[model samples]
Target: MVYQETVAAIKQLVRDGVVPGVNYAFIDQKDVTRGLFGAEQLIPGYEPLKPNQLYDVASLTKVVGTTNVILQLITEKRLALTDKVSDFLPEWQDQRVTIRHLLTHTSGITGYIPHRDKLSAAQLHDALLTMHVGENFEVKMVYSDVNFIFLGWIAEAILGQPIQTLIQKRVLDPLRMTHSTFQPEDPTRCVPTEVSPTRGLIRGVVHDPKAFVLKNHCGSAGLFSTLDDLIRFEQAMLFNTGQPIATHWLTELTRDQTPLGKQWRSLAWALLPTQLPVAHNCIWHSGYTGTFLVLDQTTQQGMVFLSNRVHPHAPNEAFLARRNAIINTYLAEKTVSSKTE
Candidate 1:
């Protein structure tokens, strides 16, 4: 399998101290796959990685957990993009921020905490409480985590449940993502994230300090999952063309909303824009924890890759270069033909 070569190359790069650990998965309309390389997770013992092994998905939680809840709330008419943040959280109305502003990170929120400190699990998340709103030019489209911070709170206000509980009920339960969760549930089955002196083994525990502090169930980050579980969640968003969400809310979500790196985003899905012509469109997303997933709806094919790449050490910048090559390789292997044109 060429994917083996792709894994080999990715693994080779990491063993050379390129990345901390790499875990990846890919999907088509049918089968799913998870591959691993490096040991940013376990150390010294040479334990082989497994498909069910959980890793800190980092910002992937934005889509897989918190964002999906937002979609459900919107579908139920419990929320709206145009709805001001203060509608659900009265304090947010003070800033007069809207869901659109929050989703696109242009809400004038000065990200709530440091990348290492963004996790606010059980706290009220009193967004503007600590954020600084940054400089004027930087506000054009700030990708602030605080936006989701408020979204999480807003979801709780509307749903009347903890954000984690709501995620399981709406998204995780439906998809049967057995290997995924916002809070660290099972220690043994999970791949410990970092072996750092301060954090220890980190197995089944979230490695992101922000998530760790925020009760491990914040909206912006803090969820542990396998690449396999991740892909299935992505595929679930494709239940359309006569499906419940497709004709209604999913369509709204699948449509591009702008400011999301040239793609229109609804909840967790980002639809790519085309300059020319094509047949079917593509819905995709990537994770900052050395993970990426892109689904080419046109070909009914998709790819997923996950890594603790940011653990123990920073992720290798070249990992993305390799990711691009592997994606093109997979698409070519499938002989993907754009239906969008």
Candidate 2:
């Protein structure tokens, strides 16, 4: 019954039809508590949500896959945060953008390709490379998938392999995240995402438009992972054991890497917004597919929230409001618990 309030809040979300269901886990250095609430699929067929079912972790892929691999490469001295984007991809005209800028989302890279999902993989790559920075370059913090998209390609270029293979060898396998993958081998075992107009029921396949187009080449999104596997990732990060990433790099990821005025960003992770002292050391990231990860390095506590809010239809503002409430409640509870300890 630990985290009972947070658990009740999530159950209410399902009861209100905000999400079909949610599979979540709360982790600390000592133990992990997991919960499964509601159904995994309610539209095409009613399926009871079960443990170990893969959820399309959307942009969590950026942190769990691309960012992790990038850090490992840096640890191995194969890459540097200061390395210019143009150095790896000559088509990238901006010499000022560096690996650090992309990780912290200060790249200021801006552009939009119309019907970007309609483009072929090669076409998308070329268009993304054409995206240029504006006057805001490095002056503001803008969360953009384009940054991670470029990071994914850079990892591939440095390793001379596809991003899928690179992530498997560098991040997932090393961390023992066996169920995490860009490609899900069995569709039924995966939680269904949105029912896209073009793709119908998006089960197993990635729901991110850019990732769907780029397939295995994608870095921005397109990862399917189970709650158990993500708990493994969180434990690795918290304990700094059995992970390929160096201890220093892992520590750096939890600290603010951005300037004072800007929204605080850690390396590929967003710091929690609150006046609490612990908030400064807590990092988090969310996937578009109703998934998110939060880790408090100081307390050695973390959480994994996975749901299919986009399933059957897209989510509205109300869904988001409730989702934030659930997360906020959890954070508030954790804050109180930390004080007592």
Candidate 3:
């Protein structure tokens, strides 16, 4: 089976100590291509991971959760991609950066602010109001988390609710994702992340320090979800559900809008160009903390891999390289099949 082959390729890498645990799911329109195959809790000797276990989604939050909220605001006409971000956060006015630049990571904002340790969400918002954007960088797609952190505030202002609440009412509840959320607070249905000297055996809590500062409600890195829930989110996007977002904004969200060396990134995802010459309509996004997903809209298909792969250790690029190779190979197969048919 192609699914089995793909699973094996990922498993082979995991077996070689490439990643600690990987909970993956695939969705192909009516087929609902969902399955999980991987080890779990790679801390020396723990019981194997269950299919329902959760993992930190990391920057995948930027693509799935944060980007979705932005699109929701666009549909409501509360925001515009071309609208200047400073209109919402007037401190950003001096820079004259627009929402598109923020979404595409071209706002020339610095990568991070260590505000997590010292600010309440309201305090943090106030801090952001007073802080200044750096002047030394070029305006381009820099892929920073701070951009989305600010967008989260806009989501709150536009929707009149916190980001977590917006995600619940707008996203998770809409998709019936019962088990996914700002986890950790609900410890009964959560899994552990990393064991650290400061925070030993951290279970059901966010591993990201910035998010930790928001009390795990930060927009950039606070989501905890199962592989199955992620597949459902991908399904919604691939189907392009009309009730949630305008058709064009959804396309804008997934469209390849930036030139990233070889691949172009869309609003919150990466576009695997036709020149990858494999898939005609392929876009993907990967999480920093050992999670990855790809969406092939042309095929109405998606794949997700969720893992605490960096547990007790950091991630290696091998999984990413292999994943791309596998995805490209699948695209190649489809290409060949098309010719034969």
| Candidate 1 ranges beyond 4 A from true positions | 1-12, 33-45, 111-124, 127-139, 239-254, 259-281, 315-341
Give the TM-score comparing model 2 with the true structure, all chains together.
Answer: 0.95
Candidate with top TM-score is 2
Better of 1 and 3 by TM-score: 3
Global lDDT of model 2 = 0.86
Q: TM-score, each model? A: 0.80, 0.95, 0.85
Per-residue CA lDDT of candidate 1, range 1-341, in tens? 23565566667767766565677666655666667666644464556565557777777777677776787677787788788776677654345567877776666665434444443433435434455445532236545566776787788888688777777777777778876777666786766555667666666776666556766336777777777777776676554422224346544554656444343554455565432234334656666666666766544556777766655444457667766676656555444233332
- List candidate 2 stretches off by more than 4 Å: 259-261, 273-279
State the lDDT of candidate 3 residue by residue for 29-116, as single tens digits: 5575555555666565565667777777788877767778888788787888778767776655455666776677766665344644
**Candidate 2 lDDT, 1-341, residue by residue in tens:** 28889999999999998899999999866789999999999888899998889999999989888998899888888899899999999999879999989999999999878888789999999999998898667778989999999999999899888887788888888888888888888999999988878899989888988888899898888889999999998888888788667788777876778643356898899877644553456788998889999988778889999998898898644677887788899888887777777
> Where is model 3 more than 4 Å wrong at Cα?
111-139, 185-188, 241-243, 258-263, 275-279, 315-320, 333-341
* Candidate 2 residue pairs in clash (backbone atoms < 3 Å): none
**Residue 102 Cα positional deviation in candidate 3, in Å, after optimal superposition:** 0.9
lDDT of 1: 0.63
User: What are the clash counts of all predictions, listed in order?
Assistant: 19, 0, 2
Q: After superposition, how far is residue 322 of candidate 3 from its true place, in Å?
A: 4.0
